[model samples]
Target: MFTNEQVDRFHKDGFLVVPHFLSQATSQRLLKISHEYLEQIDLSNHPLTRFTTSDKDHLGDEYFLNSSDNISFFFEPDAFADVDGHHKLVKPKERAINKFGHGLHLCDANFAAVTSGNADVSEIAKGLGFQRPRALQSMVLCKQPEIGGAVPPHQDSVFLYTDPLSAIGFWIPLEDATRENGCLSFAPGSHHDHPVTKRFVRRFDKETGEQLDGTEFISLENREQIEKGFAKEENQKWVSVECKAGDLVLIHGSVLHKSEVNSSNKSRFAYAFHLIEDTAVYDKLNWLQSSVKSILY
Candidate 1:
């Protein structure tokens, strides 16, 4: 459970950085397992799934799906103390662009759509003031590259459209995330009120042919212009979440947030888990007319 002050901050700011959520030992152990899993799946260089055009360009024909699927990295010493699945749990990454420029080097996806982590997320959501709980959605995000792999600024809500206003996220940096390596920057309290926009188009890397279209990315310069276009009240309140390994940031469903481009020689990795409302039966508010009218009248 979170303190009143902590929960208050989440409502007011649309985000909160919880420090040291994972113990050092757990962090090290999880890191090791991630590596082992990569090897077992033969994802040595982390050749993940990329989106090609259509059926004609199906990314994986030679790469067969590991029949022994649903493997767990959370076995025993697994970092996540809890479990559940359903929404999405992805390990996303990006490398570099080849000579063709279109030959987008490394953009891949691995181990996704998980139902675990509900217990963990439910508790967090209640602390933030959600009365009823339901299993919402969760996912992992990774973008580690030198150049030509900048993720455009965007919001998750626009992408994974779901229910109830309780959707919130937990973003963890698997590695030390910094401005140099593209940590996330957010427009504070944008969630409380903001204009909804069209889902932006996605791009694809040349080499992998993985489509980069996501509610999570957009062009940098375009982002700047969009931010500037906001009212002065909105611009002054923007906040960038730059965390080190082991830190976690909680974000609201409607928050306006995005990451910077990785210009560093090293790699960048981060994981995000979100919950809508967990298991709580909201019979009255299940419908807009009933829920709203019931409350208002």
Candidate 2:
């Protein structure tokens, strides 16, 4: 549970960092499970989907889109090397993946233990004024050594949209996150100024009204208004947030945040999940959808 001062800080700054939120044993257990999942990946029949937010053209494919209720793997853009006319993995498959995500908490028992129905998480959610918090998507982001990609500045609500925008991100570092290893950075209090003006939605065929294969980002505002909003954000200063293993960083859904590319020899691995108020209406057109019953503690 958080103190009154900590809650005030979160409301004022749009983010809060709690040192050693998880025990070393719990952190290591999660990391071990992540490694086990990675080691079992069979890339022979994989489509080799590279996860990137920078490229709009390469956003989501069938493998990525259909991962809402199932565990799935995604590769880093630089994880492959062109061999002859075919693309080959530059490293072992375990080290080459960028992340495996979207449904770990619902499908995996170990992850579900820490994520769903946890006393600590439930307490935190209640303290944050969540009456019925629903755990939605979960992922293990692997910022691989030397090839980790930079995440573009964006808000979480753009992807996991709700009627009143109640999405919150819980990010826990599994290893030491440093400036050299692609730690998260944030524009302090940007959530107050930056409104949710864009949404990442699932496209559909106009003639048949059937859902399309990929996703796209659509503007809630006109072009001129969106341009002006971007201009306003260009002047804001960003502060790097570095943390040790087991540290918890709570991110506001509307906050502008990003991470740089990892240029170091060390890897930065982290577990993250999103929660939304069940009272809010979840948009049907959002890219992620789940049939599994959401965990509510």
Candidate 3:
């Protein structure tokens, strides 16, 4: 079940990790599915792409949602039986790394790249200690501890299809996840207050001189306070959950969290499933869906 300390930490940090949510068998099953899925598509090159691979700048890859994994995940039978309820899997648009791409892509960048697919909800919910059955949007993150495997320090709520404020995540580690590889980090209690929104203008890279379009120029969140080194002051206030295979972390979706990079030569991988409210609406921010159909090819 959920512990008091875990709950407290979740509230403060926007995320929490349960030591054991998935059995070794379950994690293996999902990973197996991923290996098969990876065979059919062009997904390995994108560091941070919507397709696959870790390509961070392939923001256009966000719309690439044509995987058997996604369809199966959104409508899986177990999905209908959860406490918070089941959520859908939609591909997301990656945030702009440069200046020309200003419009918000309708799909969210929930790291759809790594999630293998929708989970076996009944089994997953039961494993997470939810008695009555629950559904959630979960993704499995697989990382190999090579250099540059670190995820950037962006917040999850900022990476979404909509502005929903409450979500409890189940972060499961299929292998022994350590801080040296890429684990997760969070800003405690960030959920209760006003959202920390970052603003920026896309600019050319200083060294590469590549133009960055539609990027944040500044932030309206508690800029001064967040920068004040509260992390160093409150040891407990800043916690990064690490785990072994079968271990899981339940987190508040609104928590400001980011994935650490795997800087080692060894292989490190974990799958994370994202769950949101059952009733959340995923409106398409891309209005030109019909307009550009025939013109561009």
Leading candidate by lDDT: 2
**What lDDT does the true structure give each of the candidates?**
0.46, 0.88, 0.42
lDDT score for residue 178 of model 3: 73
How far residue 115's Cα lies from its native spot in candidate 1, in Å, is 8.7
Which lDDT tens digits does candidate 1 get at residues 217-246? 323334455554454433545566778776
lDDT of 3 by residue, 136-214 (tens): 2334354543432445444444443233433345566666777877677766665555354543223446687665442
Best by TM-score: 2
lDDT of 2 by residue, 1-297 (tens): 578888899988889998989999999999999999999998789988988787456567888988988889999989988999988888888888899888999889888877875788888898899978999999999999999899888899999999888999999999999999999999999988777788898898869889887888887856466456453678778999999999999999999999999999998999999999989999778999888758575
Top-down lDDT ranking:
2, 1, 3
Model with the higher TM-score, candidate 2 or 3: 2
Q: What's the residue-level lDDT of 106 in candidate 3?
A: 14
TM-score of each: 0.57, 0.95, 0.54
- Cand. 2 Cα-lDDT: 0.88
TM-score of 1: 0.57
Ranking by TM-score: 2, 1, 3
